[model samples]
Target: MERTLVMGILNITPDSFADGGKFFSFENAIERAKEMISEGVDIIDVGGESTRPGAARVTEQEEIERVVPVVTELVSIGANVSIDTMRSKTAEAAIGAGAKYVNDVSGGLADEKMAKLISRNPNVQYVCMHWRGHSNQMQLKAEYEDVVKDVKKELDERVAQLLKSKVSSDQIILELA
Candidate 1:
């Protein structure tokens, strides 16, 4: 039997719908990550941006500052860390800080450079999520005759694009959300 991997979310944003502001501080975020690891989480996904509907966008620098430290600390503690971000710059910073995965909710659509970044860092795993748009406007673009078929088609297109950008197929992980 295949073991199910449990990924715990460590949102260090002030506006996330779940646990917003709870882990905004460095100490709180580190504590939460430690708690998740102690609870048997296979991976801790660290996010600095709030993807909640109508959530305000944060600057790239701010996002880096928010997550890189926590990611570095988690990795030092021997926890597998995944950076939950759509921006390539933020992903790059997190990867530099020792994150092993990039959980991009935008599926490499939001930022044109994301695929290239992933390609450059061949060892880092990439989580490509099916996304219609940003959280604030994604609902408006959710109209589909057959949701499953449409999502599959979109994901296939994304995969093709990532391949064209030189991202290895083996490094890609598909996510329906």
Candidate 2:
């Protein structure tokens, strides 16, 4: 039987939906990551910005400032790190800082450069989610004729676009959220 990898979420933001303010500090986040690793997590996904409904957008610089340090610390401890971000610049910085994956919730729709980033980084893992827009306005786009079929169709189109951009199939991860 194939084994499944359990990924742990480490949100380093002050306003995330579930664990806001708990791991907002770098030290706290690192501690949480260590705990997760001890608990058998295979991957640690670090999110600098909150995607909660109506949350304001975080600038690339701010995201980098929040994420890179955490990624760096995690990597130094031999953790497999994933950066949860929508901006290509932030993703680049996190990768440079030692993150191996990008968990992009926008599915390359929020930023055009996202696909190109994945294409350029052949070894970097990319997660493409089924998202219509940013959290602030995503609720307005929740309508779907057939939820499952529509999501599958949309993911297929996005995956095709990524393949066209020279991103390998193995590098892509799909989320039907």
Candidate 3:
């Protein structure tokens, strides 16, 4: 039987909707990751940026500074880690630091180079989540006639783009959220 894997979110951001800055500090983020592992989480998804509505985008350098160290610490502690980032640069940095997955909520749309980056790192897994737009403007773009159909179509398109970019099908994981 196939068992469901439990993935825990570890937001290393000051304005995360889930944790509300509880894990923003480096030490706090690492502690939370360890706690999640002890609590039976199979994967720790580390996100440095907040996607909360009307949230301003953080600089790439800031995001890298926020995420890479946490990912490295989690990997050193034998935890399976996924970098939750839209920018390819951040994902590349995290992967270099030993993260095994790239969780892009934008389905590779936010960053044009995301697919190419994932393609080059064939060992890394990519989470292509369905995103209508950025948090600040997504609600305004949510007027789909057939939500399910539209979402499916969009995801398919993304998968095709990824394939064209040479990212293997096995490396891609489709996420509705």
Q: What is candidate 2's lDDT per residue for 3-112, written digit by digit as tens? A: 98888999988898978669999999999999999999999999998998899988889989999999999999999999999999999999998889999998888888
lDDT of 3 by residue, 48-147 (tens): 8898888889999999999998898889989999999999999999999999999999999999999999999999999999998998998898898998
Give the per-residue Cα lDDT of candidate 1 at 29: 92
Model 2 CA RMSD to the hidden true structure, in angstroms: 0.8
Q: Could you give the C-alpha RMSD of every candidate to the true structure, in order shown?
A: 1.0, 0.8, 0.8
Give stretches of model 1 more than 4 Å off: none
lDDT by residue (1-177, candidate 1, tens digit) is 999899999999887789858989999999988988899999999999999887888999999999999999999989999999999999999999999999999999999999999999999999999998887898789899998999999999999999999999999999998
| lDDT of the structure predicted as candidate 2 | 0.92
Off by over 4 Å in 2: none
Residue 21 displacement (Å), model 1: 2.3
Better of 2 and 3 by lDDT: 3
